[model samples]
Target chain A: MLTAFFRWMRLVLPRGDAILLAIALIASFELIGALVLLLNSKVSPVDLQLARTFFLALTAFVYGIYRVNEFHPLAKPDYRRWLETTPWTWRNPLPGGPVLLVPQDVVVLALLMGLNRDFSFQTLYIPVAFLSFYLANLMAINWLLGEWQLAYSTGFGLGLGGLVFRRPDYLLLIDLACYLLTRIAVQRSFRNFPWDDSHQPCAPIEASKLKGDSANHRLGWPYDSLTPAKLRIGFRLHDAICFAVLLGWWHLTLLWGADERVRFLIIALPLIAYVGIPLLRVFPYFYMHRSPIDVWGRIANSWWVIPKFDCVWIAPLSALMLNFLLLGWASWYEWTVRFRYFEVTLPTDWRYAVSISLAPVGTTAVSLALFLIGPKLEHWRLTGQHRIVFQRSQEFTEL
Target chain B: MIQLQQVTQHYGVRPVLRRIDLTIETGELVAIIGPNGMGKSTLLAVMAGILSPQHGKVIIDGMERKSTVEHELAIRRRTVFLPDKPWLPKNRTGREFLMGVGRLYDIPDDGLIDHVERLLNVFELEKEGDWPIRSYSAGQQKKIALSSALVTRAPIMLLDEPFSGGLDPSGILALKHILKHQVQQERATIVMSTPVPELLEELANRIVVMRQGEVIAYDTPTGLRSLSQCTGPLDEVIARLVHPRTMENLEHYFQERPKC
Candidate 1:
């Protein structure tokens, strides 16, 4: 069974051992860092608890995503075809379709538990609830429908229940019940697998139901859902909305007489959500859509050109607008209201001075950086080759 | 003329087409007949610009494929390559898919609509045309894919196993009449690969027989029959030219079977 699992892993990961080694090295580094953090005496109990919960929840979320992707019926039709036609049968124990747990998962769990020995039973239940929920619906009739939501909700509910009840005994009972139910459902699903029924013709009535379901229809950004121009406009609109919300929250925090730290944190949310996330998503599109034909020469050039052009122009403008809004809102609030609820006062003058000086400068810096590195990054991504930074030593041969 | 000049292709280390050279003239119906795994599909793919050959070039109407994006696009506008297993987008209806293909080939909207309706009727797929391609059976999907190719009205049509994929007798007869009309009236050039050469013997102007990534023979049906000294069907001539021991192996296998 272990051999079969390894063989399956090898088949799935054809990029060879380099990727596996990279993953292992990264995991080891994270574990060592986590252990060092755990051993520190200055670390507060709240910080430790937060770290533990974040890592555990992150593990559960990553595992849930992996399982959903692995079990998605339409994700890899070629792989499924190969599996169905191949002579190899699942050698894992019955009732548990296939043992997809990798060595990294076990190592991560062990390291996490070892670092936090005094962890509550709820921390242990987090992974169990998530895994059970995924297993139950992994082979369900409508596995695609709300599978991620179910897994996440189960983990969240279990963790919350454990915290509220403050009773490990009841939490254990609930966990056991969930596990048993998952086991029975999985066993039945495996016994009568719906391989043939998977290809059932969807009824015409289902089409109407899916008319408004953008989640199901979203193939990818800027690929199937929207044209390049539309995607650019959509991103601009999204950034504008984020900017408005952030400014509103900042004003609210000011009105409530929050401290400097909270105010600064509130302002950072829009930067992360709008600028960072959009930049990350735009790279692939940039790489895919770069073209030799410019806008003037050809009416229909590469799809990436418009999006890239929009990013270069619109992103900086949006950032500047957000900064202006922030500065303007602070000025208005300072002029209109005087707060006596808290000791810390809003530094409206310094805020205005910093916003005015830094807004255009920061925007210009970001724009320049994007213009300079964006195309290079796109090229590097498309062509999987990179020039060596240092010259190789002639005498350095394989040992 | 569509010319493959010393074209060679390899999937990994295994060579599928080994320096194949062939010229297919305009309005010519060329049949690529061979045993399985003999690079017939690879040849068609190279010609269609779907797969780039490792060596040599594919030239269509004096424009070399892969020389420039504009050149490749020009060739694509004039050619329609139907792969053996056409991947139809599941969410789209058959009519929508055909129309999309027509639009891609820059067919006029009015002409495209009329052509799609005619194709659906001719292929007897009018009932299934409105449904999503996901709900289509293997045969219906093949018919729709064929309809898409026909809707293009391109001068060059490269079909890989058009008959073997799943077509009723009537659908096959309709396709035959359609291809014949396209070749004679529209002066369209066609290159199709098929395992069964009997179907193409009467229709194809020239037959190219391949064996293990190399062309063994390229001649007219009558020329091949005379060369092989076989008065039987084109399949028999193909077998004798490419796989002489196929009949012997079959006889041996049958003799080895236990008496019933």
Candidate 2:
């Protein structure tokens, strides 16, 4: 019966991990027993108990990592490929292993919790460590696959749990909600099996024979050019999710009374990204790449601005101007600094909007300038002409 | 088609390519003749995607070069760049290198092996072909490198200083004929940078004479001769166009009387 129960406790762990886990089980109890004997007035019993529980939690974190590594189809490219070739659907059990959290996973977590249980809420760390590790991996898998909605949901949920530091119950509730959502994410993601370009960001297996690194092949011309990994896809709808999360953090920080510098920093960090990203794009688009007929050159030669092609600059210039105008408003109104005074008191509604909404609102304006308001790339390529000139040495003394 | 638009390349603050905009259509064999340090190799390197230009895009076959994974892989498979000094597997034999390169481009084994053997005979490296690259002479190494590029059967070829790489007279003749056959028979696009324009006279569809990182003249051999107002050899026409003061300097040298 004991052997059967132990077998039931094994979820995603392989033979090596199972053996190591047995050793860890021995270590956990031995360390606790040793600490109890070695206890002194200086080392409190509570600290000893906490240390023993912390060891179990750390092990659970490792298990969480292994769980995702072994369980997720995205983690195993070979299995994923095989699954694609087979006439398999989400309805059937995966040929290799389970996708969703199984009863065995709960038994594993419950076993860890049982080992270090103190009847206090502090024992929640074991489950949190396991699930946090699991969901974090899930979040990354989704993020890499471009499921930004799920990624941000897990990220924001995890972040919110961290923010409510004192409440274990709130963390556990959020973790449960995240787990259920992850199960939904798993189902949704699995439905799109044999995914095209599903990025595998996991650690490489050192022993794999057929697998080779970048160093193995000489990625020279045409291959290098045609397959360059450097293309930037600017401002997807997912930017809105990230922008909301940043602002949400700001709101939570303010409502919960974080440090003044920290409060300002949360908004300021993203504000830099908002302003800086568009500036980087617009600057490159204009820097040396000028209109075939510049405003000054055209005004001088033809005495006309030439709205036909010159309109290309309007969106970038407007983004810049709008940024300055918004920044100027931010400066004059003293939105970020005003929060210092409300260190203990509750912030008012319009002021909250002005201060907290600054980063996201500015980002939206900038993103719209880049994505929505455009002499679109396809149109610009077919029509727009640019005057290109660079410094060339006239004196050639060589044969 | 290979299009370079507003491409600028530099080393430190010194510009090697200054806003180079050139389009080489399919099946066109263009020769880049320029003075040393005048961006001849740099131009080929940029088009080959060995180096990304600071300010523009390289569009090939209606796809922007290096823009995406598929585009890059497709471009790589179709294009082959033979640098002046190509890195060879020192431990591998010349035939092995050629076969490996052919296989890399997914050429069938039977044909690839036959092609490697034929390339070995044509280049006159039949004996050295079986010997490791480290055991070969510089000229023999160049032959193998050229053969490697040929084995790929790539539609687009970028050869930087192909004729200057310690190639023997027979090897040079073989390469010239092979390049001509590729362009004429196979309709391959080749852009090669060679200091010697005389070698490219009949082979070249067009010649771009570059001076101080600038394309001073880009036209057919005849057009270049006429543009420089010299109905002489391509070398003289390019010399007149690229270094107009060289003749004047030579005249001054000849006119001067030695006091001693």
Candidate 3:
């Protein structure tokens, strides 16, 4: 686990100190926000402040030491020259090397030390921290319901470092196993592919060499030789799987939580129409440029938006269709069961139509105004030019 | 004139173009001839002002690096680069594409239609000029791209592998005529990079040979032959320089084979 964290930390930080500092600041601010939200609800004020200070200090300290130590893959063994050379790594002769410690592990240990008032004897009770965290996770699982339990195990555990607390003592061992799995899968899938040893640790290339040599590789800057079509298949597939899983979980959770069929339909309606259609790629991502030419044709035919007014008929038509579907289903249920019909009393007004038309227009005008003024405001504030530097070396080094 | 003084371009540490100096005079027809991956495209890109070099100055006329907007605009306006792979605006017809280029060059409305029509006729593309370029064959697409470059009367033309797809006799004849006419009328610097020695040898006023990202020789076809020490033909000399291994076998086969 420590090794993975070490690799991840190295991966996230870029080559230059300035970029490294900026990234650390960004992560630290996000961490601070999460901590503040966690503390604000029911936690004691003193405890909240202490926790906030501790997190900030820990983050700063870890990042600072890492920077000071120059714990970077790009800065050793003639780093400048290595960028030009084919990246490779030597085999680790010792299979069972010393287990690495992650930033989280160290933080936990530090917290334990503080709690026990054993600052001088920090390493003595590292095992206690691991055991307590594991016990907390195991106890937390019993309190979880069906979907929550699955969410805890997969999304929370696999994605957000919850799994680390479960088996903190054997964290390194667990990470090694996962690493082995990933390696085996990669090797089996790729076989003798060019990037077989791509993940192996290597040194950085010189800036001079990078500039000189990478000009003719076709993927050079100013002109990206990449075809957008090549990425579509994988991107679509991944998005579909993620959306399907999330929706399935939500539906299952709602089935357990809700009792009324209409309530369930109402909840599911927003998910399917507003989110699911777009998520599933059935509807296009953006409002504009999604079959722009086709939309223009529709506009010309008066099947879409009205000129100047820019009021789209599709939204209102779709809303009416949805309302009719719901109302019709309800009326059928009422007629069959001999229940009361409330449709005659319900109001249908033009105010809703007017508001709907105004909403997107108002929002779009505001957005356009913001977009035009944003750079000017930033320039005024900073007294610096609004320059977007797409430095490729930063990405390569960060990775 | 575009000047490259000691310009070198490297790709991931390997030098593609070594330190070199060259001046492309106005109306000069310079053809870059070299083996594949020999920085011919890089040279074209640099000359077109599409790329920035590592350790050299690329000045167009008197415009140095990031000097003035007017200079850059002038350079861009006067230059029309037909990339090796043509960028056909999908769903846009050939006429529209030509019109777009014409607009960019600020061509007069009265002359635009006539200019486009004439070039289309010359390239044998007038009948299908209204059709989307995506429907055209590779040869036809190349002709359209070449015609677009020609229509603008851009003083500097950088064509990377222009004669890639096969051109019919009439098309080839017409293209040669147009190029010759450009030199006579507009003083356009038609710099093209082609691996095919025969096509370039006939039209190229000067040929520049490159190897391992450096210019090996730059001279006229006859001058290049003299430098290469070839007696028979210019193509044979180029073959000897570019692909020496096949030359002996080719010579033997030609000598041994009965007169056809």
Candidate 4:
């Protein structure tokens, strides 16, 4: 019985080198804890809390990344190719072993819980953080691999996480729900076993080294002239909305759950998203592009706008305005979030969380809508109200 | 057979190809001729299914283009369209590109490699075929592109500006004979547009005369020759049919040349 348990532990844990690394990490943390004790009679409550939080967050992140990498075969080309040829299905014990959490996982969590036992029920927080990221990443992979179900795992985990500070009992239900839902999503994804180019790591042709002499290979306009650039077929409006809502939910949870310093990280992200995304995406189509007529020429001819071409900018511009409105709400509303006021000890209110969350939603929405709502890239490039000038390297351009 | 029924296309308010109605039989070599901006390429594009006509339909083997997924795929398998500046993969060797195109058309693997070699020799690209297409000269690029279209062995070939894109004298001559052979032996229907009236007269079974986005005339070489009332070769007659006042324009152009 003991041998069976040890074998199960071997399957659950990291390899030999990784195990040594984990031990070294725990020893370093213990050293830090000993230093605190040596310096003072006892560590301050605030310092103790901060140290535990940082360590838990770090451990959970590493654990989540390790599991996602190990359990997922798509990360490794050899495993993925082998799985494709095999008759093995997810119904069988994964050949590598069970992907779902077992008693072995509980023992690992129990060890972590024992280490950080000063805080009451700190065990629950470790599981919540580890499972949240693990499931979140898996669900994303699952969605990419063809399963459409998303957010159920991370949503319950992150949503209940904010309330966990006051009500730890409620988190137990979420932990259970997240695991079950994620398993379903993973099972559905596995059903799409023979994954295609969408999920598999695409071999970069530009970086490819073909057989034969690499000399005399030219680039640029050669390929572009033939295939042409059609920016039309990417993400669509609904996809943007879906992505935006998820980002917003993440922001909402983070705001309610984190300290003042972490809240500042989200502020620049949305702002950068608002200005940066549009410039990167929509501006490229219009930059140095040959318009059939200038603004003055259009005005003179009474041809005000080219709907097909002009419509491309609508998504980016509307999303910007919407983001501006959201910022305005955050700045002026009941629970105001002011930049550079982190030192002032501002109140962390529910209204502030909801207001700030809108920015992430708007930003993600803008980026996606700009990409997807289209006269397909081919249609736009071929028949757009512009001329395509040949570059110096371009012998000929087909538009 | 390839059929275009009332095909009209436009990018904006202004039309590129105006309500074109045309029929091309199997094994026929048709040439589209017109002045610049007369929609020769646009009409060909509509027929190639690259551009869907705003009005009317393109019918190939009684299967409408882009009508249903299965029909479109089947039609695509049986047809090959080479734009004047068709793209070539930069990293791929010329032979590799040809092999890829052959496979795309579902040609048998055992036969495809040999066919690619023969096509390379025909284009005088035996040595360069081992090199990447990106390193090819403009004329060489044109030859490889033409070879790619030929390698498909599709029943229908739509080539736009094949002669003028960039081909040496020998390259042009080789293409003329290869297209003729494809028609005579393989029973392939070819529609090409070129400024070279002499080449058109030599190879084309029928001639399509276009002007201002419309097909003004469609007939055989002898029929067009007689219709223009020219006793000499079809070249001079082509000038008259393409533009009615060619003699008047030439006389005036030379007379006005010194003054300008």
Candidate 5:
């Protein structure tokens, strides 16, 4: 039945889109369920089962169709043409290349199977170990030459490895190996993933061609190739804005007499990335995107993966995580070490726009004024050559 | 001046253009007309420095014949090459798109808006100019593309199938008028490739005929029509020359095969 369902799916969605939609649906379900639990306090066993069945059913349908679409082979000439000039840059690798399924990353599915249970480090340890082991292995590979593909391979391999294992011991060894490897491996590939330089912004003509390829053979998703640098910058910007707003809220609380320790935690994390990371930069990198442990949920099937389940999730998640970590560190420092050093206040009315922030009624009117006048004051500054990269949609349209 | 000396281009094992020698002087209005798939677009791309020749050299304004990355970007900036279908920034309004382009080319402020407004009015797009190009019809999109190319006012212009889909009679006339004006005022050289021969009869100073990746003749439209001994009109002359009888004979063999 699953195979039959997959066969039909191949006809409708391309592999890249399929993977994207799968991540989206899974994340939506998780988020919706979480929202329900938050609002209702009691989500039934039947509700949980229904959600799991829906997720598995959707995955089966998507994966099956993607596999069927993968059958018809592309011409050698065309494939070679794609490889040499398909514009699969380090920034945004086209999803048309050969897809290597790292079976280890499938272990994350095990976590999904056990999602409703209490936190069992022992039960969860196998998948974590698998994730860490492969992540470590790739870190070692990355240290040798900062090979991004291998680094990703390690993460995917470990994650998938945990799922196939029935016993924790088998998972433990693989996880241990990956962990040790990550600890010993040099972390030179860690940096910002430049979103501007990504395939999103760089409109290379050939990129559009690869977008039409079959599912498994299609190039990896865009966020799959985001560099560490771009991710860091995105995170810092988002977190800084969120932290400022949080502070503003805390300050307002002071007027209302609810000022507390959480305010201090917000101000202390600046030293962590600037001082600690550099000092311990060589230490085993254990941050999200590279972290082996699961947070509240599996990132693969969480709200975190929504924007980029295809490619959107990575940018936002990376931004959110980086900010969260940095701000968390700052908050830690303020609470433990510098209680009397600063006074932060919350705004009388919240000005920051969180994912759920409400905007002022006249924001659009204000924006239009800025837009009209902004070009008048600005001289044509050459921000290098404005490059246009075509999306996959363009090739079909061009024809 | 754009010069192509013994240029060759291939699509895999099949050669699309043979050793072709051609030159367009500065400010010359050169039109390349041919049957389909005869490397007209390829030639334009090669001349625009978009495609490097498989063999031989393309010298632009006395430069040594080599295509460098900088030279390509420089050529693209200085010369506007409009593909058959123009690339429109769908999210941007026609006015915004033109303004952004004008700014990119270092056109002065205040003047940019006025210049774009004038062009928009002339193209009968005054009402739609303020709206995003996504709302534009096919004809409007073409006009926008042509308007973009015109606004750039680059020294060299390469247009491929510029008249394919769009253009009212008045719009066509306006475009011709603009092209002529650009040549006279800016001393801009224009190379346009179109399937339609009659369209260029009044405008083109020189029409180069291409067939099967080679330029069979390069002369004025009148001269080519007079010289060719082909049976039909200009399109037929192009068709016969591009697909010689030898290849068409293969069609008979395919047709004879039994149906499955």
Candidate 6:
């Protein structure tokens, strides 16, 4: 059974390195949490319990959202086709028959259990809540797939059950029972899989959907209709606004909290979520578009050309300015509020300060590096040749 | 004239073109014929300035691609390249795509609309012209791509397997007519690559035969026939030149007749 489980895992999560990376990141986060707990010996047991619960709930929420999006009926038709053909029943007598758990479910359950200080009934509710949310999402998807009668009956029953119970424990039990029943129904549905014939065609294109000439007209300074310079400015403005909002939220939530460690996390989490997460997501697109030759070509002949400068220069400069603004605001808030108002002394460790300072510096350095090396990298990726050869040959021919 | 001097390219150690030296004159319809993975597409990409060669230079008339900003722009404005699998802007109508391409070349607004309409009609895409490219079938997408290239009205065109993308017989005939018209009326230079030699036999002024990243023969259709000593169709002559052992191998396999 264990071997079969491993085989199923291997089949589903084929990218071994990705799994390893996720594991490494999770372990590192746990290590940091442990260190914070150890350093802040003044933390009350109740506060610690509350923090753990918050972390678990956050994890479950993120996992639920991912499940909802990942299992959308219309997404990944090829994968769905494969799943339909594969034999997944307990009666099939295959090696991995009756495999129910997916990687996300296993990872979330393990994390919740591992992080809980007391292994009690409350810990059991975490996985149950997660499964209930995930299964409920799948039920909604079934309705979208045209199982209207079954969907309405199931939804009505669940709603009535929730109202009648009125107790938290009973509601959780009802959620679990409903989830199990739906899981069995989904398995049976997979056996038949009637939704294959209801494939949706591509969306029609209309003139109204296109960007109009009026939209392309200049709005104001740094807001042209179609230029890459304007795009860079707009992206920078967006980042600035997002960072300011996150900063405001952080202040509102954690300003009165007495625990220094929690306060530190309050500041750090927003920075990681807003600036770091967005950078991670957008960097690939940025790198692909950062070709110097293409940028120069567009700037030279484009309708809305920036005079006396290339648009390629804008991205790196904008990135640097945004990072400076974020780091400056963070430092100001740290000094003015945390140190002065809360009487929280700056860390004597120097390593903490150095690491925090290095985050923005490192980001700026990477942006500059991308600006300098991006064209060559793009050329290499596209044509599979060292750019130096083209550079030298062009020079030789010119001479 | 378009000149490629010792143009060499590779995809990660797998050489696609090796020291390719060729020149194409103005108003010439040149067809590059080869088997799969013989660098027909790579040669066209090099000419189009879409892929920079590692060792050689591509020169259009007097201006060299990648020389300077102005020089590159000048070369690009005069040349329009249609890749083997052209990626159309998904959300835009076919008419809008053609209009966008026309605008990029600085065509007059009055001329642009007329040219777009004519191209759409020529390719039998008039009914679907107003529809978005995302909803187009494979053949329709190919027609739209061809239409966009035609709308540019550039002096030089580099097309890679323009006919292989689900084009029906009538669409192929329409494309052939358009190619001939461009060469005759506008003195446009066209360099197209195809695996099928039959398409090029009647259309091409000169045929360039490639094998394993090297150009083996560059001649007229009759010249190729005489050189290969095959008085049959150009397809047979190409098979003789590129895959001489193919017939012998097939004969041996059939004679042996191994049981399945």
TM-score for every candidate vs. truth? 0.45, 0.62, 0.41, 0.62, 0.41, 0.47
Clash pairs, model 4 backbone: A226-B87, A230-A377, A231-A377, A232-A377, A235-A372
Q: Which ten residues in a row have the lowest lDDT in candidate 5 chain B?
A: B64-73
Number of the predicted model whose DockQ against the real structure is largest = 2
Kept native contacts, as fractions per model, are 0.00, 0.03, 0.00, 0.03, 0.01, 0.01
State the lDDT at B198 in candidate 6. Answer: 79
| Colliding residue pairs in candidate 6 | none
> DockQ of every model listed?
0.02, 0.15, 0.02, 0.08, 0.01, 0.03
- Between 1 and 2, whose lDDT is larger? 2
TM-score of chain B of each: 0.93, 0.96, 0.90, 0.95, 0.85, 0.94
Give model 1's TM-score versus the native structure.
0.45
User: Model 6 Cα displacement at B1 (Å)?
Assistant: 2.5
After TM-score superposition, the amount by which residue A353's alpha carbon in candidate 2 deviates from its true location, in angstroms, is: 10
Please give the distance, in angstroms, between residue A71's alpha carbon in candidate 6 and its true position after superposition: 38
Total clashes in model 1, counting residue pairs 3 or more apart in sequence or in different chains: 0
Error of 5 at A152 (Å): 24
2 against 6, candidate with superior TM-score: 2
Residue-wise C-alpha lDDT for candidate 3, range B1-260, written one tens digit per residue = 76788987643345578896877787778899888888998888767655545457667667763234445556666777776865555344667667656654667757987999988888888888988666787788778777877877788888888777666678778888888778768888888898778787668888888888888788888888888788767778777667667878977998999986
Superposition error at A132 for model 1 (Å) = 43
- TM-score (C-alpha) between model 5 and the true structure: 0.41
lDDT of 6 by residue, A128-247 (tens): 556656666666665545454454445544553433332446556766666665666555555555343322111111211222331121111100111111011112233333333333
- Worst lDDT 10-window in candidate 6 chain B: B7-16
Model 5's DockQ score? 0.01
Error of 2 at A28 (Å): 8.2
Q: Tell how far residue B254 is off in model 3, in angstroms.
A: 12
Residues A5-78, model 5: lDDT tens digits: 56544433355665677678777877887778778857775676566554553454334233223421122334
Sort by lDDT, top down from the best: 2, 4, 6, 1, 5, 3
